[model samples]
Target: MSRDEIIDITNKFLVEEFEVDTEVVQAEANLKDSLDLDSLDYVDLVVIIESNFGIKLESKDFTDVNTFNDLYDLIGSKLHAIA
Candidate 1:
């Protein structure tokens, strides 16, 4: 998927699942601390990412992903690798 597609999916998921403001869900929005997503929410986020991107992400793939930029890079890399 493209970067805009990823951001769009993430924005929709965040708004629907987490009840967050769509305007706040930017490409640079942090997921862990900035978004205040707990462990359960993180799992759900992972599920959505994998399901939408058709990529299986291991837990360790997010170990060092702290920011939205980190997530963007990770997703792009994983999708590229799988492709």
Candidate 2:
């Protein structure tokens, strides 16, 4: 998938699964802060990502993920690895 597609789908699920406003799901937005995700929310996020993107994301996978763009890159890399 292209970067645009990744961003599109990520935004969709973030809105649907997390109840985040679409406006808040910007590329530069801080993932945890923008989504208001805590520890349990992180677990739920892992599940949501796997279900939506078909990639299993471990907790450590998010160590360097700060913004939504970072997440898009992470997911894109994992998808590339699997492909």
Candidate 3:
């Protein structure tokens, strides 16, 4: 999948699963701050990534993922690795 598709699907999941506002899911937006995600939310996020993208993520993998764009790149890289 292309980066745009990854962003779109990730945004949809954030909106639908986390109940985040569509406008808050911007590329530069801070994932934790913008979505008010807590530690429990991270667990759900991991599940979402695995179920949707078939990518198993570790907490360390998200250490540098401050923004949605970072997440897009991480997911993209994992997809590429699998492909």
Candidate 4:
């Protein structure tokens, strides 16, 4: 999927699950810090991504994904590899 598509899906999930404003879920936003996402939320997010994108994201895969842009890159790469 394209970066814009990934961001749109991610932002939609965040809006529905976390009640976050889609406008605030920008590429530069920090997923953990800026969003204040807890561990369980992270797990749920991973599950959502896996189910929707068909990519198995291990905990280690998230080690370096601190920001939304980081996550976008990770998911984008996973989508590319799978395709």
Q: Judged by lDDT, which candidate is best?
A: 3
> Where does model 1 exceed 4 Å of error?
none
Note the residue pairs that clash in candidate 3. Answer: none
- Mind giving the per-residue lDDT tens digits that candidate 3 earns over 11-82? 999999989779999999888999899999999999999899998789999989999999999999999999
**Backbone clashes in model 1, listed as residue pairs:** none
Select the stronger candidate by TM-score from 1 and 3: 3
- Candidate 4 lDDT by residue in tens digits, 46-81: 998898788989999999998899998999999998
| TM-scores for candidates 1 onward, in order | 0.83, 0.95, 0.97, 0.90
Question: CA lDDT, every prediction?
Answer: 0.79, 0.91, 0.93, 0.86
Taking the candidates one at a time, how many backbone clashes does each contain? 0, 0, 0, 0
Against the true structure, candidate 2 has what lDDT? 0.91
Best of the two (2, 3) by TM-score: 3
Model 2 RMSD in Å is: 0.8
lDDT score, candidate 4, position 42: 89
Query: Candidates sorted by lDDT, descending order?
Result: 3, 2, 4, 1
Best by TM-score: 3
Q: Which whole-number lDDT from 0 to 100 does residue 78 have in model 1? A: 92
